[model samples]
Target chain A: MPINYYIILSLTLFVIGIVGVLTRRNTIIVFMCIEIMLNAVNLLLVAFSKMHHINQVATNPTAGTEAQLFVFFIMVVAAAEVSVGLAIIVMLFRNTHSIDVNFLNRLKH
Target chain B: MTIIQILFWLLSALVLLSAIMVVINRHPVYSVIWLIITFFGISGHYILLNAQFLAVVNIIVYAGAIMVLFLFVIMLMNLNKDMEPQKSKWLKLVGAIACGCLLLVLIAALKDIDINNQIAETNTGNIGLIENLGTVLFTKYVIPFEISSILFLSAMIGAVVIGKKD
Candidate 1:
């Protein structure tokens, strides 16, 4: 497939994620939106890596290996992030009895 | 049209639809479910691109493990109902408008890019195979791989510290 198609599809998913983050009040939903954005970027990276690999196949058979590895590490980091983030969210709910992002405004005080 | 092209369009549609549903679904549990579907759709895309390793990892990590964690948390908090307080209509409208403008600008900027003719190889490429990726990972990328383990350790400790009862 042409790279542009992948780019457009990824862009649409990312924009949906941004809209979710901006419009949603629930902190968990906002976090999920962030995950969506991350996945969008992941998809794009894979597409670009394949494009690069095809272009460089004669000179370098493993040209796109790094990008896939990078995607692997991204998944690693995202998993760790979700663990810590959910722990924080659980604690927040326990203390405040709510999960609304607006409830965090008191931190400004 | 080729089978690959058809599959690409189909997976893209599935991903976009599920992602939008994840955002607009009123119930948090349903949102999580939609997100899982979105992940599966993306995995299908990865498979179409011949990145078999990443596709499997995406399903195992994102759909199986992380989403289950999300569901568990939601159930633990009894958040199954649609209890999320609605934002003002104007605020939502503004957010949607801003995102739409951002999308418009990005499309305009990227539409005429020189690399649009490039084609990502589908259903081929051994670099995405586990053997090649493993060799590179243990050689050139070994240091970062080890550091990631340490990062995971730190994250584990941090989560426990923050989650413990005071």
Candidate 2:
């Protein structure tokens, strides 16, 4: 399979997520954008690793699974991120009664 | 383009489109749903890449577990509040400029590689054989593997501490 489509899609999705992170006032949307970015990078990494497995190298079957390994780490980290991030979001929501991120500008010293 | 290539292109389009919608959608629920669709499309990309184990894991962790938590957060929070900040026109302009700059950089970097010129082998569902993944992870990545659990533990503690209200 050509990796072009995967790369382009991942890049586009990542760009959009970055834009959302910067533009969206809602903190929930920012968190979602972060997820989107993570997913995009995961997709790209998997695609490239698969591409390497297909060409030049004889698909070591053993060595080529590194990307998949990282994907596992990515999942674990993302899981931890959600637990902590959402817990913070929930706390912020209780105190402020809103999920808007811009209002979190308390560091204006 | 061949049939598979055509299918890849189609799914890629769907993924990018849904991702855009996820960012632009006003309703919180709808945005999350678009994000789910985007994950499904990523899984399809995974299948194309012959990463069967990764594809399933992607769906399970990202599309399933993480998204459920995201939706839970959305539901737990009240949207109707006076404190919700609205985006100003200047910030929107700045965001657009940043996105455009990123697009230009991506295109510039990717232009050298012609994807069609490369002939990719057809290997499916065999890349992540359980033995293969287990050996490499156990041997090469042992430290990171051990360290990640600690990271998760700390994150758990942090969540508890920060979330506690006095």
Of the candidates shown, which would achieve the greatest lDDT relative to the real structure?
1
Off by over 4 Å in 1: none
Which regions of candidate 2 fall more than 4 Å away from where they truly are?
A: A59-61, B80-84, B113-125
iRMSD (Å), candidate 1: 0.6
Top-scoring candidate (TM-score): 1
Give every prediction's interface RMSD: 0.6, 2.2
Cα error, residue B159 of model 2, in Å, equals 1.5
Per-residue lDDT of candidate 2, residues A8-74 (tens digit): 6778888998999988888888888999899889887777676667663663544457888988799
Q: What's the TM for model 2?
A: 0.89
Tens-place lDDT per residue, model 1, B1-166, is 9999999989998999999999888899989999999999999999999999999999999999999999989988998465788899999999999999999999999999999899989999898999999999999999999999999999999999999999
For all candidates, state DockQ relative to the true structure.
Answer: 0.93, 0.66
> Per-residue lDDT for A88 in model 1?
97
lDDT, each prediction? 0.95, 0.80
Residue-by-residue lDDT tens digits, candidate 2, B1-166: 7777887888888888898898888788888899999989888877776777777888898888888988887776745444456688898889989898997899779867767455344355355656677788899999999999899899989999988887
Model 1 chain B: lowest-lDDT 10 consecutive positions: B75-84
